[model samples]
Target: MTKSVLVIGGSGGIGSALAQHYAATASVVTVISRQKAPTQNSWHWFEDTLQSPAHSAQCVQLALEQRPEVIFICNGVLHDAAAMPEKTIRQLDTAILMQRLHANVAVPAQYLQLLFSYITKTAGVKVVVLSAKVGSITDNALGGWYSYRMSKAALNMLVKNISIEVRRLNPSAVVVSVHPGTTNTAMSEPFQTNLPPGQLQSAANTAERLAQVVAAVQPEQSGKLLNWDAKALPF
Candidate 1:
């Protein structure tokens, strides 16, 4: 059982479920999000925009004090009320692209940057960044969702790079990007219409599967991108 855990973006659907999952056994659960956490869980919540590095650093410093054994970076955005995914290059807007990048890549990047020192020195730490399978360059058979795809692809690379660096300092550490499948959340509601039957998972189910995957991942698979079933996916 995990003794200590840190969850970023803990107010989101899947993220909140993950916090609840870990809270069952973890003695200390730390969460950072823009909204207040649900009052039911006894997690240590730090509400922040996570836009400024100095602010993010302070939140991370407090989390590290708990000596978390597991960390989840779940910050991401697909479509918002103002913008839907671009279907073609002509439909792409620079503003939408920047918004996707800022949420999917930059925000998580900030937290990872803040946790670098702690990750390098800590042994047996498992870092799981929520990435999408659509991010895979090799898996792009049908092209669409430009902004979301590009942002996730970039996020995958960041996880790969961090895994390599952290391995050299702490070989026991496990850092990998994981695709949490298409959960029944607001983020996926827009795209769920065409998904195959049973493809959409409930937030609780996704959380359970992700917990199992994180628990089973080994140090040797540190730099890989894994599916919800724990299968390694191509980056």
Candidate 2:
């Protein structure tokens, strides 16, 4: 059967790559983004943002119509034009922290809340939220980027909490947090220096790896934080 896939941040690097990859097998690939997709004809595009409650509602409405088998909440912001990650405690600012929280934590949680209703018990569904290894509280050996780390940690918690409820409602549905590793995207462009050789992967490569991870997930594995290689990350 042809799959129905939904990508929330379809205009971004990994999101676009996943949309392209899934389009080959999906009967209809729907992308919800604030910007226009480069390859407009490859998938159905819905111009929207999850910045506000109204937009979130619209997202749920659109997604309910699609009833996606695989949904990827790929939206995230790291060092955007308005703010960059704090290098030290003294550099931390409330405004920047709030922006990061809104983008990284609140927005994605809201999307998941609204979209969960459409996932039926009979249909096997997977929801993958792009998270970071830094989000792991137990893996915080190199502590920096306070706001970004906090936001991702909160997002991970949200995923964990949502997974419990989702499993109760739809046993076949799985919600997971994924760390895509360091990819060659605009988001990681400013911090690509001093990385080990072959550490940075292309968006297409990361997308393929992510797809494999998603495919390998089972309902019993819901709520776990998975690395690109499909190993469980420490909470």
Candidate 3:
């Protein structure tokens, strides 16, 4: 049984569900998010915008002090009131692209960097970053959603790089990117209309599947991108 877990972006639909799922079994559940997470007596909440290096470092330091065995980085942004994903080259905006990059890639990269030493030190540690299959360069047949796609692709590369580096220091560590599938979350709300019926999953269901994936992933699968069912996908 896992003793401790950390869920970044824990206020979001899937993140919150994952935290709650682990909280039932794990003794220590630490969550860091921009907004306050739902009240749970067993959980530790840290409000962090992830905008300042000093602030992020402080939160990560405190959280990692617990030596969480499982870590989930679920920070991502597909759209906002200011802009939706670009459907074509004509709709692409520099500001929007940068926003997506900062949220999807930079923020997670910062946390991974902060958590590096702790991850290497902990035995059998599992680090799962929520990535989208759309990020796969080899799987891009139907192209669009420029900013979101580009940012996720960059995030996947970051995960791959970190996995390789971490493996050298700690062979027991498992760090991989996972595509959580189309879950019923605010991030996927706008696009759910076209999804084939059963493709949309509840937050709880997604969390359960993600937890299973985390449990089953081995050190050999560290650098690959995995689907919801733990199948390896092309990078």
Tens digits of per-residue lDDT for model 2, 143-186 = 88999999999999999999999888889888999999999999
Each prediction's TM-score versus the true structure = 0.96, 0.94, 0.97
Q: Can you rank all candidates by TM-score, best first?
A: 3, 1, 2
Q: Candidate 1 — worst ten consecutive residues by lDDT sum?
A: 34-43
Residue by residue across 24-44, what tens digits does model 1's lDDT show?
Answer: 765588999988766675789
**What is the alpha-carbon RMSD of candidate 1 to the true structure?**
1.2
Candidate 2 stretches with Cα past 4 Å from truth are 37-39, 120-122
**What value does the lDDT take at residue 194 in candidate 1?**
84
Off by over 4 Å in 1: 39-41
Whole-model alpha-carbon lDDT for candidate 3 = 0.91
Error of 2 at 5 (Å): 0.7
State the TM-score for model 2: 0.94
What lDDT does the true structure give each of the candidates?
Answer: 0.91, 0.86, 0.91
Model 3 pairs whose backbones collide: none
* Sort by lDDT, top down from the best: 3, 1, 2
Clashes of each: 0, 0, 0
Give the per-residue Cα lDDT of candidate 3 at 96.
90
